[model samples]
Target: MFDYADLLTYVLLVLKRAKLPQHENTRQVLRLVHEAAAEQNVPVRLASDLSQKNPFYALLAESSLIQALEIFAKGAHRCA
Candidate 1:
């Protein structure tokens, strides 16, 4: 079974790997990402790569996983 906390941890790990500090905003972003991710039934791995496809790395470099998850959920909802 996929653990949500593990997934969230992985997101944080990736950010830290990219040299993002664990600041107040960073925690907020993680929480948002967690909530958005939970809404989409998104798995841990996809959550990790959700921003990897951007040519500008816009999502990965700027927006947090929560924002990406929100976009994913919105699109998924619209398509459904």
Candidate 2:
């Protein structure tokens, strides 16, 4: 499974510099991506180039992103 926690700090840093809404926006973006990907199969083996792959990478990424988004969103935002 692709873990977003490992990527969170880097992503947050970019968001911070961009002055983007942090947690809430992250959740929204993740959710939108997840919904968009519902029809396509996720590739299990991720390649920067096209090659043999499993079909779960996208789903896992989406789920992981959503999970990460929620953790920060609810933890940091009282309204969440």
Candidate 3:
């Protein structure tokens, strides 16, 4: 089982690859991460868990907007 941080990293990577800018929803995303983590009975946060080598950060740094869009589209379908 991946940690909340790892899962969050995955989500962030996927979102970035899908090309959807997160905008000012960091707090909301954090809340959702907290809720999701709680449901899994684990506790973690973005600031606390993220390290210098965060894969999610790498993806964002590269800023592949089109890829981010695709990833997000798939995610949206799943959620819907």
Candidate 4:
């Protein structure tokens, strides 16, 4: 389990390592996570285990993390 900050940092690291463009959608998803964390008034680390049972997981789906990952995958594919 990790906090929102950890999640954001991981994503940033991936983007940097992959040299993927930080598209608006990616930013929006990050923003949604931030907002959700704030709204829940709980540390995301405590609230999330990256499981489907958590609110964070629902937010991930709603915010389209998979799409963001797909974008990253496409960028990596291009580089390859």
Candidate 5:
């Protein structure tokens, strides 16, 4: 399986690049990502290129971002 920390870092970087106003939900997601990364000790892998066509890139809406974070959290737990 892919490394959740790396994925979280990637998502965090994307959010950083977005330069969007920080809403509470966004802050929560960021907090979760950091917590998850600290909890999960997975080996690092080379970063994979995300295609612009990916659904994630297309939908940066809050709902979609929350759902993505939820999935990552679940996956991280399973890995643990």
Candidate 6:
């Protein structure tokens, strides 16, 4: 399994990729998002529906977002 920083990078990639307009093909991005967020139980498939702008930056509600954070953070601890 990847360490936290690696997964963090993956999460960032997912978030950045989600910003593209809906008309654009996002299959690959979504797949990465699923892979990155799967462990955390974050809703990756629908995350692209969320805005890339201010307020509610993630498609996940606050609690699920926290879970994703925890998942990444735990990875960090494992490497320490």
Best by lDDT: 1
Candidate 4, TM-score vs. the true structure?
A: 0.21
lDDT of 4 by residue, 1-80 (tens): 45554465444543444232343346544554565545544344432333212122222445565665665564432111
Of 4 and 6, the candidate ahead on lDDT is: 6
lDDT of each: 0.46, 0.35, 0.44, 0.41, 0.41, 0.44
| lDDT of candidate 1 over 1-80, digit per residue (tens) | 23454455556644455343344356544654666546645444434433323111135556676776776664432111
**lDDT: which is higher, 2 or 6?**
6
| Model 1 accuracy (lDDT, Cα) | 0.46
Local accuracy of candidate 5 as per-residue lDDT tens digits, 1-80: 34454465456654465332233345544554455457653233222222111112222444565666675564432211
Question: Candidate 5 clashing pairs?
Answer: none
Candidate ordering by lDDT (highest first): 1, 6, 3, 4, 5, 2
Residue pairs with backbone atoms closer than 3 Å in model 4 (clashes): none
> lDDT tens string, model 2, 1-80?
33343234334433443232234246544443344346443332221111112112223443666665665564432111
* True-vs-predicted CA distance for residue 62, candidate 2, Å: 42
How does model 3 fare in lDDT? 0.44
Candidate 1 ranges beyond 4 A from true positions: 1-24, 40-80
Of the pair 2 and 4, which is ahead by TM-score? 4
The RMSD (Cα, Å) of candidate 5 is 13.2
Which candidate model has the greater TM-score, 3 or 4?
3
lDDT of 5 at 42: 26
TM-score of each: 0.21, 0.20, 0.24, 0.21, 0.22, 0.24
- How well does model 6 score by local distance difference test? 0.44
Candidate 3 residue lDDT tens string, 1-80:
22455565646643444232353556644555555545543344433323223223223546677766775665432111
